[model samples]
Target: MRHFSVFGAAAFACALFAGSASATQEPQAADILFERPQLEKLKGGDRLDYSYSFKSADPSLFGPAFDDRIGLRVEPGDGPDKKKVEVEMFSAERRRAAGPFEDMSGNPLLSLMLEENLQRLAAIFQANPRYMKTAIRLALRNAKATPEPSEGFGDAPGWRVEVAPFKDDPHKARMHGLDTLTYRFRVSEAAPGEITEIAISARDAKGDVLFEETTRYAGKH
Candidate 1:
């Protein structure tokens, strides 16, 4: 499973998280950053929600840019920075599908189609691709939260995460691409403040193992 050779798809997705460069400025530092709302900042078990959007740096991915929102909740912690997270849901509307041609790897072409027509003069409008951006949703609960490392994931701070598809989801059972996903996060163990490795694997309605991964924190945060 680790050597699936999903390099092309993974790299393509990575670019979407990394922001695009502007003519007058250099590229931004992070592709994605989660911000806490004013309400979540309050203490005593209050939950917080926020939205995240992703766009590809290269316009060639699709005719128009893609954007989706993910809702998240943070549990109130005793300390100022302490928090527990709940990934509520993700939705990808106007998602694209496979295209007609193939790539260098002789793989079928795929893309996320946009709902909105592109502006004739825009760069994105000119470089249309076969992929469509889809909305992703999640129903999250007060699961245990872990702390990330100080340095960073891959040498910094964060644990790896794996999310399984919901039972009601149809296509996930049919396609390999839609099965499940794993992520690495910059967080550490909650108690004893010791850096640790984390992995999550969920089974489907049929009880088959669906998602799993392992993450380690190198140093204290």
Candidate 2:
């Protein structure tokens, strides 16, 4: 597991290592780069969104794979205090590749891959605020080493993240023979800016949250 704060033009990268594999097949990893959240100034409040780009760390090992992009939305509530905020996130296949995993339109395996990526992206977003509170907090609790803060949308003062694990049946996650059980959580936040609080969670099978560190943003408690 790895973690880092995402702010500014500097990219936040993480590697997803494939679980155990056959001797003939070497384990591979995918490098994912998360762009800083982009803030859009709305009439009443503001809308903040971000993008995630990923590729195989070793193309030869994984072959040509499609890159992915996810979009996140934050809608502020009415009134000066803005007590409620609406949060949404989604991912779309940017480019398709010609290979066994191609034509993901109807393939369950490929579709599951896309869904997993989106869920992972959402988890990162949900963990942002708490991850920002204390450098040591992120490192000790979340397994994310803190990075120097740079100029970016999420760099604003008072920004925070909160995550709550839920009790539910484990989700079945499989890709290219790699299988794992994962739990779900409800991640929300009330940070600086127009966002008073966001309510959203990655659905089961949407993503895996194993070994993820989550906590309430400092000052919230």
Candidate 3:
């Protein structure tokens, strides 16, 4: 009976095993972005499907563009990174999300992508999901991860972390502009649970896309 999101979700094996608490864990684009250990380099049943898109621009107060997925499998443990995970959020058929299943070492698409985008920005700015998770953990502990390797999606080895936790919010006009949200993460080890992407966007003051959400990485079927 958790699921108020900003995760406390564990069921289907605790969001891909031990990838929750510790202020939401996941992905690997070094130099910070939730510490390290991108999911014990993966194993068991090995799945990590993603593709949970979202969109806004006021779909009558943020709601519209939809798509869902964040499935994971992996179940083998007792050693070697002690895994035993399972997740399947935003149903489309594979509805899992119940509770109980954890072990260690990060990655569960980093707490189901920032606790489902801070539980939709704490219900569209009513705020206080622990002060929006301490302002996105100080914009991901002062983020920085550049590396950008591609090789046409095959050579993989990528990295790209960006932050904008509320752009110097001293409370930023009550977050109307949502302090111009931006929180990208594009990790890669050529996929297989290494996070090929995760995104969140915001725009205003003349730009566009008031809100956005992405998930990417759709391999490992």
Best by lDDT: 3
* Preferred candidate (lDDT higher): 1 or 2: 1
Name model 3 segments beyond 4 Å from true.
1-53, 58-64, 77-80, 84-104, 111-139, 143-179, 184-199, 206-209, 214-221
As a TM-score, model 1 comes out at 0.24
C-alpha positional error of residue 72 in candidate 2 after TM-score superposition, expressed in Å: 3.4
Predicted candidate 1 versus true structure: per-residue lDDT over 76-128, tens digit per residue: 44445554433322354533222211111111111111112111112333422
For candidate 2, what is the total of clashing residue pairs? 4
Candidate achieving higher lDDT, 2 or 3: 3
Candidate number that wins on lDDT, 1 or 3: 3
Against the true structure, what is every candidate's RMSD?
A: 19.7, 18.7, 16.1
Q: Per-residue alpha-carbon lDDT of model 3 for 1-221, expressed as tens digits?
A: 33534555333123233333444344422333444556677877777787788888788888778777767777776778767776777685535453334664556566667776787778876788778776766566555567778534865667788888888888788788888888887776656656677788989889888988988877775
Give lDDT tens digits, candidate 2, residues 4-57: 222201211111122312233321111101111212222223333322223443
From the highest TM-score down, the ranking of the candidates is 3, 2, 1
Residue 111 in candidate 3, Cα distance off native in Å: 9.4
Q: Which pairs of residues have clashing backbones in candidate 3?
A: 10-99, 10-100, 11-99, 12-86, 25-110
TM-score of each: 0.24, 0.25, 0.30
- Check candidate 2 and list the clashing pairs: 3-144, 129-160, 129-161, 130-161
